[model samples]
Target: MPTVLVIDDEDMVRLVLRQFLERQSMTVVEAEDGEEGLRLLRANAVDLVICDLIMPRADGIGTIMNIRRLMPAMKIIAISGGGRSHAMELLKVAEQMGADHVLGKPFTRDQLLAVVARCLPGHPMTVRSSARSG
Candidate 1:
């Protein structure tokens, strides 16, 4: 199983994603904000990172840019939901920053799983389903 590092400020969002991803048997590490997320990335190995674009500290774009600079091999998935236009803008920024995927908020579990699959093509859980997990 490939490990996934999920970064978001919302406790509910993290709890939900933790439950959903764990159900697929993937190991998950969590960070409340991009600063902590970056710290975790630096200290531990992770196959993919799913992060929120808007946060109090070290927003997604900055984190993505920094992470790419520090660890070019790291795969990133940028997500935003509170604002659609902002999310789109951040998605573009994330792309420019070398993120592998960008997802909007209120997405289905399946959508997240699909993005994760794209990030880690050989992971077993990634290839197991095509339907919406939510």
Candidate 2:
């Protein structure tokens, strides 16, 4: 199964993402911030990184740069709902920073899955259910 690292400061965000990814039969590792995410990345063979652009300890841009430096081919999907009216700008920067894809916050599970499929085309992310309740 494809392994995904989800880095977000909010507990609810991480929980929801874990639920969404798990339902798709993907393994997920959670991190509160980018620093923790990097540490997990080093220890685990993660296939994807779904990171929040705005976080407390170490932000998404720095984390993306580091991942690019460490693993040039690592797949990254940067998410930002900065909710500060600058979320789009941050997402744009994430794209320029080498993130394979970017998603604004409050995205649906289907949208997230589509991006993941695009990023890791070789991996199979079969959903357990066709319901879009999420």
Candidate 3:
């Protein structure tokens, strides 16, 4: 099973992602902040990282850069709900910085799964859900 590390400050977000990703047979690891996420990344073998851009202590940009430096081929999916324009800009930066995909907050499960499927094409486990979150 593919392992995914989800880094978000909100407990609800982590819980939701864990439930959904686990249903897809992925090993879900949770981290509350970018710092914690980095620590978890070091200790665990993560295939993908779904990170929030506006996080405290080592933010997404820094974390993305660090991951690129450490694990250049690692797949990353950055997310943000900062604002309409601002979030888009941040997501753009994330893509430029090496994030394989990006998603805005309130994204539906299908959207998330599509990006994930594309990220791990050869992976055996695929998310098969149509649940929406908004």
Candidate 3 residue lDDT tens string, 66-114: 8889899999999888455678788888888888888888787777887
User: After TM-score superposition, what is the CA distance of residue 98 in candidate 1 from its true location, in Å?
Assistant: 1.5
TM-scores of all candidate predictions against the true structure: 0.89, 0.90, 0.89
Q: Which runs in model 3 stand beyond 4 Å of their true positions? A: 82-85, 124-134
Q: 112, model 3: CA deviation in Å?
A: 0.3
In the range 1-134, model 1's lDDT, one tens digit per residue, is 87889999988888988987898888899999989998998788798898888888678888888888988998888888675565677677778777878887887888888877777888756444453321
Question: Which lDDT value does model 3 have at 132?
Answer: 29
Candidate 1 Cα outliers beyond 4 Å, as residue runs? 83-85, 126-134
- Predicted structure 1: clash tally: 0
Arranged by lDDT, best first: 2, 3, 1
Error of 1 at 7 (Å): 0.8
Q: Which has the greatest TM-score?
A: 2
Residue pairs that clash (backbone atoms under 3 angstroms), model 3: none
